[model samples]
Target: MTSIEETAPGRDHFTDFDLDSPEFTEDYEQVLGDLVAKCPVAHSKVAGGYYVVSRYDDVRQCAQDWETFSSEGGFEPGRGGEGGAKLYPVELDPPYQTRWRNALGPYFSPRAIRSREANIREQVNYLIDGFIEKGRVDFVEEFAAHLPGRVFFGSFLGVPFSELPPIQKATDDAMRGPMEGRGEAWVAVATFLDGYLRARQEEPPRDDFIDVILAGVEDHDGNPCSWDHKLYVLTDLLAGGIGTTTYLLAGIAHHLATHPEDRAALAEDRSLWSGAIEEFIRYYASIVALGRTATRPTEVAGQSIAEGDFLMLSFAAACRDPKYFENPHEIDIRRKIAVNPAFSFGPHRCIGSHIARLEATISLEEILRRLPDLALAEGGEPVYSNSTIARNMDSLVVTFTPGEREGRTE
Candidate 1:
């Protein structure tokens, strides 16, 4: 599809940029390309009134300036927290954000990550075993979703496997599901977490995240973290940890199936996997956009904004900015990226970044070694949802060289 600039004649400001429309989202590179070139800072009327900052410097500025752009506001304009639940650490700034980060950060500390590595490696191989001999499988359903579902739900979060389906469905819907159904989707997520968190609060077994937080994690005031805040943070982990990684792994599979040369190069040299994963993240940034409500009147990228306005920091777009990257569109695994804002920027950056990279890197190394010739499955169409929030593939059907699994024994 031609860019809005070329076809729209004298139309300077773009209103055709709808994140929820696949027509716009499926072709995100081209869409963001146009925005970066023609409109660094543009307004969208989609979710009421908001500005999208598409440039690298501008987005970094907005993300770094927590006082000006507050994550505390619910995604949309005019919306705030639910009851007393702030959006956990991401939604908070300064002393509160610091308190929560310090308290829960230990859960994913280096020692914790090293402990999980063995299981993560085992799980990757186990999931591959299910489809390695079959020669074809929906990578998303059988592998991408299952790997994280097991890792995040069963291992990390300690959520009952029985409850995963509804929780996963609710989060997926709330982030990228239909517009009319969004309220229900969000409500479903909160309801499940509310019950689960409330139960954990009473029990205080300290076995998992909820137990730890409920048992003793304190707020800025050194008081026990509020129940509502705990729920929000738990939701953040469930939603963020599961959703982002699922799509990214599927995206790596999609890229490998389509690009034979890069796949061959990586398979030929195991060392390339580390650097390649970084490039892959830069290419397919999963968290499409994060919201911030302007606390005071401010200008981004030389564009003026009012105090009450909301802003969208497009990390996906920022990663694609040519000013920061040499060949912004092309995927060059060998390229040494000075920096990529895929995990976001500043204090609000994702906390689970180390574990996420470990998951992707290990999964890729094993999958490539075991299923060397996997190709996009014939007669099946893959799906990527077009949404304002998350960018994830729904399905990735793939066929591989058969009997590769039989050659190796666990």
Candidate 2:
């Protein structure tokens, strides 16, 4: 699809770009390519207007200089903290944000995440078993959407598996459901988190990730964190944990279904999986952009940014910058990458990145070994939904040769 710039002469991308608009979302690769090549720093009038930074060097510099471009302003462009709860650490600047990251960092370290590999594999197989006998399934609904929540509840947060449905539904609705009903959906999510945290406080320590939140960190003013502040931290973890990885999972499944050669290559060689996952992250990045506020006057890619002005660093766009990548659009699993901005950069880089990679690695390994003949359903096509902050494949139907369930070996 041609960019909106070509299709509609009046809507110049430099001044009238809307990340969430159908024009941009439907043909984002071409549109983002245009932005990177022509206007590295483009302005969007949508959501009260903000500047977008699209080049690889520009995004890295802005992300590294937190003092100049503060995150305390929030990540979403027009709507900051859409659900009414502030996501801490992410929405905070350094020193203060530093304290929180320092406290929570150990839990997401490679060794810590590595320990959960067994349970993660079990969860992956458990979901696959549900549809293995049927010869067909909606990968998003039946598989991708459920794995994160299961791992979150069963491993990270230590919630009961039975509680997954209501919380997961509330999160999905709050994130991508109808605009009118989002407020109520967010309320459900917040209410659940509040109750869960309060209950955890009264119980004996479990020495788990939630325990770290309950222990609390010093606030920006050097005082002990407030009760509500603690709630904000918990909210961030839950929201991040439950939803973000689904996009990567669904995208990979869809890619495998559509490209037989890529699937055949991956199925034949297991060693290719690591580089493949990183390439998938770079090529099919799910995070579109994240917002940062300029603290004072600064210049990025020759574009002047004033104090209090909003700037969106496009991680997806950075990954596609042609200067750094040869064929930025095509999926090359063996491609070498020095720096991948898929998880953003600097201190606010996704703490869950290790877990996300592990999940994708195990997921691809099992799906290929078990369902060798996976292909798109006869007439099924992927439907997508986009927001200012993230984009996801909503549904992907696939047909595979029916196989027997490898029931739990416990």
Instruction: Give one digit per residue, the lDDT tens place, for model 2 in 221-274.
Output: 989998887888878876775557888898888888888899999998888888
Q: List TM-score per model, in order.
A: 0.87, 0.94
How does each model score on lDDT?
Answer: 0.76, 0.84
lDDT string for model 1 (130-208, tens) is: 7777888999878787676567765676675566567767766775566899888888878977887776666637555
What value of lDDT does candidate 2 attain over all alpha carbons?
0.84
| Best-performing candidate as measured by TM-score | 2
